[model samples]
Target: MNNEQIMNLIQEISEVQAAGNYVSFTCNNFGIEVFVMRGEIKKSKEWDRTFFFRKMFSEKRTEEMYQECLEYLNKMKETV
Candidate 1:
């Protein structure tokens, strides 16, 4: 995804979280699952065919999270 697309994804996720719901992002074989409520991340995970990783961000910042998502997406695209 491009910058605009990523930004839009972030916006959507934020909207979902604000509504007390969850959102997942997926492209090809890679996926990111996020659950945030009351400004706390209850669950966050990223996965691909080769690996599955989970993380909890106690001090998660939106910009940092989005940047990490972009990096992972870029890396996945490169490997494809």
Candidate 2:
């Protein structure tokens, strides 16, 4: 996606989160699942709004969570 499209997607995700909703998408090719949720960090007792991306096929996954998250959203947009 182009920069504008990417920014729009990011804005949409942020808006959804701000409205107390969870955002999730999946990438079939990589069997990756991405989730963005609002919560708190127990250790710091701070708000910890974040994204959790995981490879569905394996218990052990790589450190490419960011890439997987983007690819999942792109795939979702294509489907929509």
Highest TM-score among the candidates is held by which one?
A: 1
TM-score of each: 0.33, 0.32
What's model 1's overall lDDT?
A: 0.44
Candidate 1 lDDT over residue span 6-33, tens digit each = 5676665555445544345443334344
- Model 2 scores what on Cα lDDT? 0.47
Candidate 2 structure quality by residue, lDDT tens digits, 1-80 = 23463455576665554555456544454443446544321344533233443345233333354555555444444443
- RMSD per candidate (Å) reads 13.3, 10.6
lDDT of 2 at 11: 64
Which residue pairs of candidate 2 clash?
none
User: Which residue runs does candidate 1 get wrong by more than 4 Å?
Assistant: 1-46, 49-60
**Clashes per model (N, Cα, C within 3 A):** 0, 0
Q: Which stretches of candidate 2 lie over 4 Å from their true place?
A: 24-80
